[model samples]
Target chain A: MNMHTPLMSASPLVLSVEGLAKHFEMHHLNRTLFAFENVGFELREGEFILLKGENGAGKSTLLRTLYRSYLPRAGHAFYHTREGIIDLALAADVDIALLRRREIGFVTQFLQARPRVAAEELVAEPLRLAGTSYAQAIEEARRWLAAFGVKPELWAAYPSTFSGGEQQKVNLARALILPQRLLFLDEPTASLDRNARHALVSRLAELKAAGVAMIGVFHHPDDVADLIDREISLEVKTIADGENNVAE
Target chain B: MTPASSMNAALERQPPRLMLADPILTMTGIEKSFGDVRALRGVDVTVYPGEVLGIVGESGSGKSTLLRMMNLEDMPDRGEYHLALPGQEDLNLFTLDRFSRRMLRARHIGIVYQNPHLGLRMNNTSSGNVAERLLMAGERSFAVLRARAKESLDASEFPISRMDARPSELSGGMQQRVQLAKAIALEPALLLLDEPTTGLDVSVQALVLDTLKRLQRERRITMVIVSHDLGVIRTMADRVMVMRNGDVVEQGLADQIFQDPQHEYTQQLVHAKL
Candidate 1:
């Protein structure tokens, strides 16, 4: 519950998550495990902030909750602007959907299955959400992919057969193609090779310099060592920690 | 009856001990593509018995794709794979049918994905997840299965007390231990691991990699590992294959490859990452 104000080196804060709490209820049992408790963080436009934690430390939970993949038991996500903040939780699903189109990008370590989508269509999704026409979105996505050395011949391929590294690169290509004010990358470098990871880090650095906001979750500290402007390290609390403390 | 019993009997009869001839697996002119996107265009790889092969490449270089094809998990669109089974004639792995291919994967090829949870069902107990694959592959009897699973899990250094705990209840390292237990329980002849140490702590990586090396030595498993990390490659691989742009740039012993990479592309790749 510390307020992490922006540093002098970066742009003003672009996105903020406040008082996030999540509880997971197992289907077979009535027991509910608290995944997160009042977790909070901030992302300045184009700034790289490392999210570090051990396994089951709620890092993934917090990221998933922010993306609306899992509904938070309680919290609000704020997209900051010059005059006011656009609160995602307060907005309707449609309104939030529009907001995602224009400002937010979520990249997962694994590809989420969707309907009849190729790499181009997948990358263009955020733009499509932002009210861009399909044709325009495809063009923009292709341009972005090309910049990263992804060839045109590969754009139409389904992601299922793509290697883990290939799929991850494609996933990154999608998130990064649009001019997003906010980006959340969960375990971005875990599956990537050193060269690819370096390429991504440099690309992210350039985006940060251009004032794009990002919050990256990574277990490998070295991957984000140079990119990170600040860090919020989570206490390594396992299931055992919770059990011992709770039982007492 | 097993698909190739006489072959198994021959292999069992003559154990290829310590630096055997001609290696266990060989891939030559293997090509794969999904629609128009050609993944591996003319790739050649060779893996020897008790040899740890590290496949290093940039993203989208077809390294992982190439490894998948070796296990028949991902089939090649063109070219044939000649597997050098110890006592049997060279088997064209591409010719195997679905059932046989799957059976082959169960008995001979096991892969560890980057994600720990992908292989194990999270809702099930540790022992359940560990035993489920083996049970499906064979070893259906309840008592023997449980005892076998318990013994294997313990031997993998994954604590037996948590054998009944679900994935959510286990730490990441413990969860990986669970996956390792499953992969080793079957005792596959070749193990395909993709970025096996990427997510774990350095200490945990050492533990897991050391355990893998030990198991590889004891079982004489030929490991075809895909890693982007050169440090990991240095520790695990006896021989290394350097791939780039969907092509093999260089292939040699790990020491030589690390010390003096012939291809400028490989040199750049080796130097750029660190």
Candidate 2:
């Protein structure tokens, strides 16, 4: 595990990614694109690490890879699971599903939902999955909505039809519903206004205090700059005919 | 983490045998009828947590009716029913109010019908149909429901790219998978299946069965499967209950029951399969 952050404590390391790499094959063009290579990081409990880089820097790819959204082409992501340390890259799909359901949480920039599902249900899902009673889960969803300043009237409205900012609020609320041990947030506040952003920051702080480890990519770093324990930058790698051209 | 120390810890942490200690659902003298036809007659059942219980019988044997009563889709005409949920009493479901019963059903029980059409909304988008149960369970956040529905669809091995299409647009096997995704989207404690793979082709049946087995084992879901196909029961069930003409003929471990059936009906059922 690479301890590049001064904020590390005796708290157990939740995730340790070593020499992780992601590459995409363009079969149509008969070429390959190396999104990132030799990326490594260690996230301890309660620490928040920020991902910094310009567009096309593979920042999102790195986040996605760690979250197991995209399979890593190489290396290991050792996660401290109830079953002990298991590599996310090599773990069975069933194991990954179990971890995602109970241990890990993710918030993405775009909101993807079923058409016509009400907003409250969206927020209550995580709580429900955690075995909370339906009434209690919905009640908690209502509480989160209030915290984010989502209008009560829109509680029954579908997030799929909501404005970009409103949808992001729902995304943030859903991700934060259950107390996650590890959280990956990608531009969670990109569409939020001042008040919502502040609310998100405060909620994130509460999670941090509760010893939840987090890795995030923020469009506005100033909003959460104080909460960040460390920073990792991913340089874009352009490959032509199997040759890598690194761009800093 | 040293290998020797970790091995010792793993041995110490091995879960105690929970086979029959925790009863998730218990039914005594359950009876149901459909007008002139008496579907179930004083049937008793006890399901332990994390155990797969199979109910096997032919059509009109009341196996499906028993499943419906367990999940509260239909009320039992006579008998006491109790559902054991964590941190709560063994709830007499018949005594609870309709709304409370509905809430419990949404939270604790998930059922997949023989016909996917009955379980899924044919007109709605695939994701919408999959998320319908959560919506009904009082989840009001569309974003969460949609995201969970998509997640469930992916987990069930339904193509993610086609999640936006209508259920009617998908093949029969795909539709069944979608319905399975929808049923378990809430991650309910008890999953009820009534001939879940009956209609699919043999190859598709194998695939669906593989998916179901993996899901049940991964989630540790307590399942009550009612199927005419003894092969399904043999593969998926830990215990087998043989039902005939609304009456339970015999009950025992799947291996024992299949190896040497006690009841004549069970013998015939096993013999037919052979």
Candidate 3:
């Protein structure tokens, strides 16, 4: 067993999980698939944990589950919120929403681009939702976009028309623009170039210094080795193994 | 001061929570049916002050039925509808008598329909239509009626110079603006909009949406908007309720509904929009 110790043990604990498990039941095929089981971890403020796993190891699924996008089949994820500690796995929808709006930020590999909305406006949306005036949000969005190496001319263009790399940059800028206390990054550097990756690393370093706790899956872990405090690797479960494991 | 105590003080001084504010309208266990067709089946909704709640669904989804119930245009077969206006006792809308309902609608509620023809009298001038609503709400003075009409018209971004023109003489978007002006002329606490920009050109729709957004922000009026167009709902609503076949499949903050829909039906609706 790999001992999971926080690099900054003095910092406050932000999240604690135990016996977390999730599965999918394929009704048509009479099959049950296990994504991950008995996954547990502890994270503290300003700590960055690198989620290491091979393909289909349920790394992204774990992140999404913690974000309340997917419900867990068993176990508890106790999130220490400003209001108080709550079991995120069983928290009410409204409580989860409040947490998402204020504390948690998730960045997926693909950007679900809305048509006709400019890149800058799309990136500024989170700030606008948090009650910043439109003009100020746009100003901050422009600054972030420039920092991410998005050209000035493309800032006003629709992200749906942008290339994959461009879209990822915009997505990164949008999610990173706001200083969320906890962040979940699902292969955020998957499609970026060398320069763009460097920009993202520096931005993340700044966030770490500001005490933002994060869990991320990087395609190439070497790019962020300096930022990583610990690692949790998932063991991929095969179909044959899942067939014997009944979903509880 | 100790660091922990100072942090606690900072948390104490945090801004008042918006979500904790008292709701302006609450509908519980709402049910509606038309003969053999069940248009709504046990839905509950709550609207906070100054927030825009968007109801989105395909045709026959009961979204329109729910919006109509808010304005008392269509009564629900069973439900508890309560309105809490400032400086007034909480009123149970379902129990109000006919006369009281009419008075309540005229004084405190405003509705803008999909078709401008349904909302505006063709013969009345734009400002006249607005003044007529004000008059119904007991504003008798000619000067006050005209002033209120013009003020609301200007707020809706309808040209003051064109306030005298009839609805027929105005463009589709302008006519919708006139209806908006008329609806808001009384400065009602609740505004119900049913597809307020459905048939206009995209550019015109944008103009009307911008006007509505500004009006809601400037006046802080609580609004419930029903639209089949996801784009319109996305632009206008702070929160969204997704319905299908007389059942509310999902309700959440707009960003969540649009970005991470949970239910399968909601996922389909979002993907269709995408």
Whole-model Cα lDDT of every candidate shown, in order: 0.70, 0.79, 0.83
lDDT winner between 1 and 2, please give it: 2
lDDT of 3 at B167: 97
Q: Interface RMSD, all models, one decimal each?
A: 29.5, 18.4, 12.8
Give the per-residue lDDT digits (tens) of candidate 1, residues A19-117: 866654332233355566777777776677777766666777677666654445567677785446765534333233434546677766676433235
Q: What digit string (tens of lDDT, one per residue) describes model 1 on residues B1-274?
A: 1213322321232222222256578777888877788789999776666678899998888998997798788788777787665554477888889888888777767778878776788899989987886886788899988998898798678888889999878877888778878887887778888888788888788778867765663455778899988888877886778887788766655644664344556657766755
Q: Which ten residues in a row have the lowest lDDT in candidate 2 chain B?
A: B10-19
Please write out the lDDT profile of model 2 over residues B74-130, one tens digit for every residue: 898898888777765555788888898888887778888889878888999999987
| Candidate 2 residue lDDT tens string, A91-177 | 643345456778888888677654545799889987876788879988999999888889999999988788888888888898898
Q: Return the top candidate by DockQ.
A: 3
Tens digit of per-residue lDDT, candidate 3, span B104-206: 8888999999988889998899999999998888889999988999999999999999999999999999999999999888888899999999999998998
Q: What share of the true interface contacts does each candidate keep?
A: 0.00, 0.00, 0.03
lDDT winner between candidates 2 and 3? 3
Residue range with the least summed lDDT across 10 consecutive positions in model 3 chain A: A239-248
List ranges where model 2 is wrong by over 4 Å: A1-7, A240-248, B1-274
